[model samples]
Target: MEHTQKLIHKIINLTPLSTAYEHTPKGKRQLECYVKNTCGITAKHLARIYRVRQARQLIKANPQLSLAQLALECGFSDQSHLNNEFNAILQIPPAKYKKLIQQ
Candidate 1:
């Protein structure tokens, strides 16, 4: 249990959950099960939320960064993916969020 919590913390700090699972001592399936049971959210969902959270921080810190660049830095596949996920989580597009912050 202590080890699992450590693993989860490590994963949360790392970008791109796919690669994080690959590096885990246990198989991906076992890690997924442990995370789901312990956290009450699937690892994939947690990863997406963490990515969006990181992107939001970056957006605030550097409001001038382009969406594509933010997407790449946030481990998103593309701007559209970042937009979609960001919208889903925050109910606002990244571009609009940046503009609001800048104003």
Candidate 2:
């Protein structure tokens, strides 16, 4: 339990969208198993959520940033990818969210 918590903490603190289990001392399969058993979600899924959360924070902090720039900073492949994730998670596009925040 303590080990799982430590791993989860480490994962949460990692940069957005960094889902590589290779950085962990444990094997990829072990890390996956720990995450799944502890959090009931795959590490990849958690990473995606974390990325979206990070992007939201960044967007709120800098509403003037372009979607493409946000995508790059948030570890998304491109603007479309960021848009998809943002829409999926927030149920609104990034531009709309930014407008809402700015107002």
Candidate 3:
């Protein structure tokens, strides 16, 4: 939809990637607004999606890292927490996903 694309472009133009997001309510509000206006998704879902992507990158960087370490680095509670989210977003177990990538 042109309207959605325009909204996304406006948001991207307004919010720089270097903007700090953790210390202020305004940043959180902006993220929530962008998610709603652009993707019709919730901030909670977006956060999980971001964490999963970050976890993937971390795994690639450190293939020897334990799942627990990856989870902690990505802000999840522990290995099980990361596993739960990874499964929810990726529909596969984290171990299997890691093995598949290694091979």
RMSD of each: 1.6, 2.3, 6.3
Candidate 1, residues 11-97, lDDT tens digits: the string is 678546666765667877888888899989988888888889999999989999999999999888899999999999999999899
lDDT winner, 1 or 3: 1
Each model's lDDT comes to 0.85, 0.79, 0.68
What's the best-to-worst order under TM-score? 1, 2, 3
lDDT, candidate 3, at 13 = 35
lDDT for residue 61 in candidate 2, whole number 0-100: 93
lDDT of 2 by residue, 15-103 (tens): 43234454456676777788898889987778777878888999899999999999988888999999999899779999999999999
Candidate 2 worst ten-residue window by lDDT: 14-23
Per-model TM-score, in order, reads 0.87, 0.82, 0.68
2 versus 3: better TM-score goes to: 2
lDDT of 3 by residue, 1-103 (tens): 4433443443333322224343234555665676577676765565677778788877777777899889888878799999999999989878888898798
Quote the lDDT for 45 in model 3. 64
